[model samples]
Target: MPLTFRKSFQILPGVRLNINKRSWSITTGGKNGPRHTHSSTGRRTTSMDLPGPFGWRKTRKGGGH
Candidate 1:
């Protein structure tokens, strides 16, 4: 298997900091609510769960080359 590294720290309620081999990100939200993530690599992600086995997600890149 390929080497991998990832860790997460809870900064506050509904907030966390995630670190990986390539980048770091901040996540905010609860499991039942909409969540958002902003990465050091200039990528942003938003996700939310539905009533059933469904979910919603969106991704938007930052102003970077």
Candidate 2:
């Protein structure tokens, strides 16, 4: 498998957001076994995905996420 790089931001003490800048794909028996492409549309993740102090809450412009 290929490795992925990401940048993360901490909105709160235990809350975080992640951003990825690339897309990845894998193929078997192809000229290129794996391929990675740079993308402008990135992915995002938040601490709300896990069971923790964070929940489905609205965030203000300069507040939580």
Candidate 3:
């Protein structure tokens, strides 16, 4: 959906909004479809477990909280 905005001032705690509606259609790919993929040798090289929320910092600095 597309929307447009207009300028206006508020006095006593008021809110303003703009709304727009749109029509959607599917193309040749169809609505929600998965893409193609290549197969792997099943080496299991990656780790499935990691420190929860702060995983990003651990990659750069070398430790987890």
Which candidate comes out best when scored by lDDT?
Answer: 1
lDDT, candidate 1, equals 0.93
- Model 3 — which ten-residue stretch has the worst lDDT? 37-46
Model 2 Cα lDDT, one tens digit per residue, 1-65: 98878775555443344456654322112122321222233322221222555344222332223
How well is each residue in 1-63 modelled by candidate 1, as lDDT tens digits?
A: 898999999999999999999999999999988999999989989999999999999998883
In candidate 2, position 20 carries an lDDT of: 60
Please provide, for model 3 over 1-65, each residue's C-alpha lDDT reduced to its tens digit, 9 standing for 90 to 100. 95655433322222222222422111121113321111122111111223554211111122221
Which of candidates 1 and 3 reaches a greater lDDT? 1
Clashing pairs in 2: none
Worst 10 residues of 2 by lDDT: 26-35
Show model 2 residue runs off by greater than 4 Å.
1-5, 22-65
Check candidate 1 and list the clashing pairs.
none
Query: Between which residue pairs do clashes occur in model 3?
Result: none
| Candidate 3 local distance difference test against the native | 0.23
Q: TM-score for candidate 1, please give it.
A: 0.86
Better of 1 and 2 by TM-score: 1
